[model samples]
Target: MMISNTPPPPYYAVIFTSVRTNDNEGYAETDALMSELALQQDGFLGMEHASSEIGITISYWRDVESIKHWKDNLDHQKAQIKGQKTWYSQYKVRIAKVERDYDFLKK
Candidate 1:
């Protein structure tokens, strides 16, 4: 995926870092579904992710209330449960406010 074209400073980011378990059981489908569901949320701005032995996904949001709403979503909660019981060997979530951001592109 390309970089998310987020707005200027003052957005929230939910940073999800994860190491996977060996089980391939439906993980990819679940992941894709979550992405689709997140995009439909009220304040979802964008998302970016990469993975090797570990994975990191940062989902941008309009505000903390939006983040909370997403977290409380029933489907998302089910996915979280499944991740803990199946897909992820370990993971961490960090929420932060983006007060500043910059990027450079090559021509």
Candidate 2:
């Protein structure tokens, strides 16, 4: 997804940044599945993603508890293991609470 249609501020964002290994076997399918599964999670607001050599995905959440739940999800945990073993060379995750937000769109 591009810009995430999120709720008002004071929510949380989990920023996942990764650099892929040369091998991408099953990466696309796994990534798609993860996105779909994330949407099914409780308190999941939305997500934005982009990739080149480096990949970045930011998922919005209602609270820290929600974020923690996503992390501990069984399928997601499997994906994380797969990513570490096959897909990603390096990765980082950051969680932050949004205090305020504003956007301008041209119609």
Task: Name the candidate that leads on lDDT.
Answer: 1
Model 2 residue 39 CA deviation (Å) reads: 0.4
Q: List the residue pairs that clash in candidate 1.
A: none
Per-residue lDDT of 5-91 in model 2, one digit per residue for the tens? 889999999999999999878989998999999999999999998888788999999999999999999999999999999988899
Model 2, residue 64: C-alpha shift (Å): 0.4
Please give, for residues 10-29, the per-residue lDDT of candidate 1 as tens digits. 99999999999999899999
| C-alpha TM-score for every candidate | 0.98, 0.96
In angstroms, how far off is 92's CA in candidate 2?
Answer: 0.4
Clashing pairs in 2: none
Global lDDT of model 2: 0.93
